[model samples]
Target: MMKYLRYALLAVAFLLCVTVALANRAPVTLALWPDTVTAFLGFGYAVTLPLFAIVGGAVGLGLVFGLVWEWLREHAQRAEAAKMRRELEQMRRAHPETAARGATQPPRDKVLAILDEADGSS
Candidate 1:
Protein backbone atom coordinates (compact mmCIF):
# COMPACT_ATOMS: atom_id res chain seq x y z
CA MET A 1 0.00 0.00 0.00
CA MET A 2 2.81 2.41 0.87
CA LYS A 3 4.68 1.45 -2.30
CA TYR A 4 1.57 2.12 -4.38
CA LEU A 5 1.10 5.50 -2.69
CA ARG A 6 4.69 6.44 -3.39
CA TYR A 7 4.28 5.48 -7.03
CA ALA A 8 1.08 7.54 -7.26
CA LEU A 9 2.84 10.57 -5.79
CA LEU A 10 5.70 10.17 -8.23
CA ALA A 11 3.27 9.96 -11.15
CA VAL A 12 1.56 13.15 -10.00
CA ALA A 13 4.86 14.97 -9.73
CA PHE A 14 5.90 13.80 -13.21
CA LEU A 15 2.65 15.02 -14.69
CA LEU A 16 3.07 18.38 -12.97
CA CYS A 17 6.57 18.76 -14.36
CA VAL A 18 5.38 17.84 -17.84
CA THR A 19 2.60 20.42 -17.61
CA VAL A 20 5.07 23.10 -16.50
CA ALA A 21 7.45 22.28 -19.35
CA LEU A 22 4.67 22.40 -21.91
CA ALA A 23 3.32 25.68 -20.55
CA ASN A 24 6.75 27.31 -20.51
CA ARG A 25 7.83 26.41 -24.03
CA ALA A 26 9.03 29.95 -24.87
CA PRO A 27 12.73 30.50 -25.59
CA VAL A 28 14.67 32.76 -23.22
CA THR A 29 18.10 34.37 -23.54
CA LEU A 30 20.57 33.84 -20.66
CA ALA A 31 23.55 36.17 -20.42
CA LEU A 32 26.71 35.83 -18.38
CA TRP A 33 26.95 39.60 -17.93
CA PRO A 34 25.20 42.89 -18.76
CA ASP A 35 25.55 44.38 -22.23
CA THR A 36 27.64 47.36 -20.94
CA VAL A 37 30.00 45.07 -19.02
CA THR A 38 30.35 42.78 -22.04
CA ALA A 39 31.15 45.72 -24.28
CA PHE A 40 33.82 46.99 -21.88
CA LEU A 41 35.36 43.54 -21.26
CA GLY A 42 34.88 42.20 -24.78
CA PHE A 43 34.24 38.71 -23.37
CA GLY A 44 30.56 38.33 -22.60
CA TYR A 45 28.61 35.16 -23.35
CA ALA A 46 24.92 34.34 -23.82
CA VAL A 47 22.82 31.34 -24.68
CA THR A 48 19.22 30.72 -25.67
CA LEU A 49 17.30 27.97 -23.96
CA PRO A 50 13.70 27.04 -23.25
CA LEU A 51 12.32 28.58 -20.04
CA PHE A 52 11.54 25.16 -18.64
CA ALA A 53 15.07 23.97 -19.35
CA ILE A 54 16.60 26.91 -17.46
CA VAL A 55 14.28 26.47 -14.47
CA GLY A 56 14.77 22.69 -14.38
CA GLY A 57 18.53 23.02 -14.72
CA ALA A 58 18.71 25.50 -11.84
CA VAL A 59 16.54 23.25 -9.64
CA GLY A 60 18.69 20.21 -10.43
CA LEU A 61 21.87 22.12 -9.66
CA GLY A 62 20.41 23.32 -6.35
CA LEU A 63 19.48 19.78 -5.36
CA VAL A 64 22.95 18.47 -6.15
CA PHE A 65 24.62 21.30 -4.22
CA GLY A 66 22.32 20.79 -1.22
CA LEU A 67 23.12 17.08 -1.12
CA VAL A 68 26.84 17.76 -1.25
CA TRP A 69 26.60 20.44 1.45
CA GLU A 70 24.63 18.13 3.77
CA TRP A 71 27.09 15.28 3.29
CA LEU A 72 30.02 17.54 4.11
CA ARG A 73 28.23 18.94 7.17
CA GLU A 74 27.68 15.44 8.59
CA HIS A 75 31.29 14.37 8.18
CA ALA A 76 32.05 14.66 11.91
CA GLN A 77 28.97 12.63 12.90
CA ARG A 78 29.82 9.89 10.43
CA ALA A 79 33.41 9.75 11.66
CA GLU A 80 32.26 9.52 15.30
CA ALA A 81 29.85 6.69 14.45
CA ALA A 82 32.64 4.77 12.71
CA LYS A 83 34.97 5.30 15.68
CA MET A 84 32.33 4.04 18.14
CA ARG A 85 31.68 0.95 16.03
CA ARG A 86 35.38 0.13 15.91
CA GLU A 87 35.74 0.61 19.67
CA LEU A 88 32.75 -1.62 20.35
CA GLU A 89 34.16 -4.33 18.12
CA GLN A 90 37.55 -4.11 19.85
CA MET A 91 35.93 -4.35 23.28
CA ARG A 92 33.94 -7.40 22.24
CA ARG A 93 37.12 -9.06 20.93
CA ALA A 94 39.03 -8.26 24.10
CA HIS A 95 36.36 -9.58 26.51
CA PRO A 96 35.28 -13.12 25.69
CA GLU A 97 33.08 -13.36 28.83
CA THR A 98 31.05 -10.26 27.92
CA ALA A 99 30.64 -11.48 24.36
CA ALA A 100 29.48 -14.88 25.64
CA ARG A 101 27.03 -13.26 28.07
CA GLY A 102 25.61 -11.16 25.25
CA ALA A 103 25.26 -14.20 23.03
CA THR A 104 23.54 -16.24 25.78
CA GLN A 105 20.88 -13.53 26.33
CA PRO A 106 17.59 -14.14 24.52
CA PRO A 107 16.59 -11.58 21.88
CA ARG A 108 13.45 -9.53 22.55
CA ASP A 109 12.01 -9.86 19.03
CA LYS A 110 11.03 -13.00 17.16
CA VAL A 111 12.91 -11.96 14.03
CA LEU A 112 16.06 -11.20 16.03
CA ALA A 113 15.77 -14.49 17.90
CA ILE A 114 15.52 -16.36 14.59
CA LEU A 115 18.55 -14.49 13.26
CA ASP A 116 20.56 -15.24 16.44
CA GLU A 117 19.66 -18.89 16.25
CA ALA A 118 20.75 -19.00 12.63
CA ASP A 119 24.02 -17.28 13.53
CA GLY A 120 24.65 -19.77 16.38
CA SER A 121 24.01 -22.70 14.09
CA SER A 122 26.40 -21.38 11.49
Candidate 2:
Protein backbone atom coordinates (compact mmCIF):
# COMPACT_ATOMS: atom_id res chain seq x y z
CA MET A 1 0.00 0.00 0.00
CA MET A 2 2.74 2.45 0.87
CA LYS A 3 4.61 1.54 -2.32
CA TYR A 4 1.50 2.20 -4.41
CA LEU A 5 0.92 5.51 -2.68
CA ARG A 6 4.52 6.53 -3.29
CA TYR A 7 4.18 5.60 -6.98
CA ALA A 8 0.98 7.61 -7.26
CA LEU A 9 2.64 10.62 -5.69
CA LEU A 10 5.59 10.34 -8.07
CA ALA A 11 3.23 10.05 -11.04
CA VAL A 12 1.40 13.18 -9.92
CA ALA A 13 4.65 15.08 -9.54
CA PHE A 14 5.88 13.94 -12.97
CA LEU A 15 2.61 15.06 -14.54
CA LEU A 16 2.89 18.42 -12.80
CA CYS A 17 6.45 18.87 -14.08
CA VAL A 18 5.40 17.92 -17.62
CA THR A 19 2.48 20.36 -17.44
CA VAL A 20 4.81 23.13 -16.21
CA ALA A 21 7.32 22.40 -18.96
CA LEU A 22 4.62 22.40 -21.64
CA ALA A 23 3.02 25.55 -20.29
CA ASN A 24 6.38 27.34 -20.04
CA ARG A 25 7.96 26.40 -23.37
CA ALA A 26 9.35 29.90 -23.85
CA PRO A 27 13.14 30.17 -24.04
CA VAL A 28 14.92 32.15 -21.33
CA THR A 29 18.49 33.45 -21.40
CA LEU A 30 20.60 32.77 -18.30
CA ALA A 31 23.50 35.17 -18.05
CA LEU A 32 26.43 34.83 -15.74
CA TRP A 33 26.79 38.58 -15.30
CA PRO A 34 24.85 41.85 -15.71
CA ASP A 35 25.23 43.88 -18.91
CA THR A 36 27.50 46.40 -17.16
CA VAL A 37 29.70 43.66 -15.73
CA THR A 38 29.86 41.93 -19.11
CA ALA A 39 30.93 45.15 -20.77
CA PHE A 40 33.71 45.63 -18.19
CA LEU A 41 34.86 41.97 -18.44
CA GLY A 42 34.82 41.99 -22.25
CA PHE A 43 33.79 38.34 -22.08
CA GLY A 44 30.72 36.82 -20.44
CA TYR A 45 29.00 33.46 -20.52
CA ALA A 46 25.30 32.74 -20.95
CA VAL A 47 22.94 30.02 -22.06
CA THR A 48 19.44 29.86 -23.47
CA LEU A 49 17.14 27.18 -22.08
CA PRO A 50 13.50 26.59 -21.39
CA LEU A 51 12.09 28.16 -18.20
CA PHE A 52 11.31 24.70 -16.89
CA ALA A 53 14.96 23.66 -17.26
CA ILE A 54 16.11 26.60 -15.15
CA VAL A 55 13.52 25.88 -12.48
CA GLY A 56 14.34 22.17 -12.42
CA GLY A 57 18.07 22.79 -12.30
CA ALA A 58 17.67 25.20 -9.37
CA VAL A 59 15.51 22.72 -7.48
CA GLY A 60 17.98 19.87 -8.07
CA LEU A 61 20.89 22.01 -6.88
CA GLY A 62 18.96 23.05 -3.78
CA LEU A 63 18.22 19.41 -2.90
CA VAL A 64 21.83 18.35 -3.35
CA PHE A 65 23.14 21.18 -1.19
CA GLY A 66 20.52 20.58 1.47
CA LEU A 67 21.42 16.88 1.72
CA VAL A 68 25.13 17.66 1.96
CA TRP A 69 24.47 20.35 4.58
CA GLU A 70 22.44 17.94 6.72
CA TRP A 71 25.07 15.19 6.46
CA LEU A 72 27.82 17.58 7.49
CA ARG A 73 25.72 18.91 10.37
CA GLU A 74 25.25 15.37 11.75
CA HIS A 75 28.95 14.43 11.49
CA ALA A 76 29.59 14.99 15.20
CA GLN A 77 26.61 12.83 16.18
CA ARG A 78 27.73 10.05 13.89
CA ALA A 79 31.25 10.17 15.34
CA GLU A 80 29.90 10.05 18.88
CA ALA A 81 27.72 7.03 18.08
CA ALA A 82 30.68 5.25 16.54
CA LYS A 83 32.76 6.01 19.63
CA MET A 84 30.04 4.58 21.90
CA ARG A 85 29.84 1.40 19.81
CA ARG A 86 33.61 0.94 20.05
CA GLU A 87 33.56 1.46 23.82
CA LEU A 88 30.72 -1.07 24.22
CA GLU A 89 32.63 -3.62 22.20
CA GLN A 90 35.75 -3.05 24.29
CA MET A 91 33.78 -3.60 27.52
CA ARG A 92 32.28 -6.84 26.18
CA ARG A 93 35.72 -8.07 25.19
CA ALA A 94 37.18 -7.12 28.56
CA HIS A 95 34.48 -9.13 30.38
CA PRO A 96 33.63 -11.97 28.05
CA GLU A 97 32.38 -14.23 30.85
CA THR A 98 29.96 -11.58 32.17
CA ALA A 99 28.73 -10.79 28.67
CA ALA A 100 28.10 -14.48 27.88
CA ARG A 101 26.36 -15.06 31.21
CA GLY A 102 24.18 -11.99 30.74
CA ALA A 103 23.00 -13.19 27.31
CA THR A 104 22.14 -16.68 28.59
CA GLN A 105 20.41 -15.74 31.86
CA PRO A 106 17.24 -13.81 32.57
CA PRO A 107 17.84 -10.44 34.16
CA ARG A 108 18.10 -10.53 37.93
CA ASP A 109 15.79 -8.28 39.92
CA LYS A 110 17.52 -5.49 41.88
CA VAL A 111 15.99 -6.70 45.14
CA LEU A 112 17.20 -10.24 44.49
CA ALA A 113 20.65 -8.95 43.65
CA ILE A 114 20.79 -6.91 46.89
CA LEU A 115 19.61 -9.90 48.99
CA ASP A 116 22.17 -12.15 47.33
CA GLU A 117 24.89 -9.63 48.04
CA ALA A 118 23.85 -9.39 51.74
CA ASP A 119 23.77 -13.19 52.14
CA GLY A 120 27.15 -13.55 50.51
CA SER A 121 28.62 -10.84 52.76
CA SER A 122 27.21 -12.38 55.93
The candidate scoring highest on lDDT is 1
What TM-score goes with each of the models?
0.85, 0.79
Q: What is the per-residue lDDT of model 1 for residues 12-81, given as tens digits with 9 covering 90 to 100?
A: 9999999999999999999999999999999989999999999999999999999999999999999999
**Which lDDT value does model 1 have at 83?**
100
CA lDDT of each candidate?
Answer: 0.98, 0.97
The runs of at least 3 residues in candidate 2 whose Cα sits more than 4 Å from the true structure, single-residue gaps closed, are: 105-122
Clash count (model 2, backbone only): 0
How many clashes (backbone N, Cα, C below 3 Å) per candidate?
0, 0
Give one digit per residue, the lDDT tens place, for model 2 in 1-122.
99999999999999998999999989999999998999999999999999999999999999999999999999999999999999999999999999998899988899999999999998
Q: What pairs collide in candidate 1?
A: none
Model 2 residue 46 CA deviation in Å: 1.0
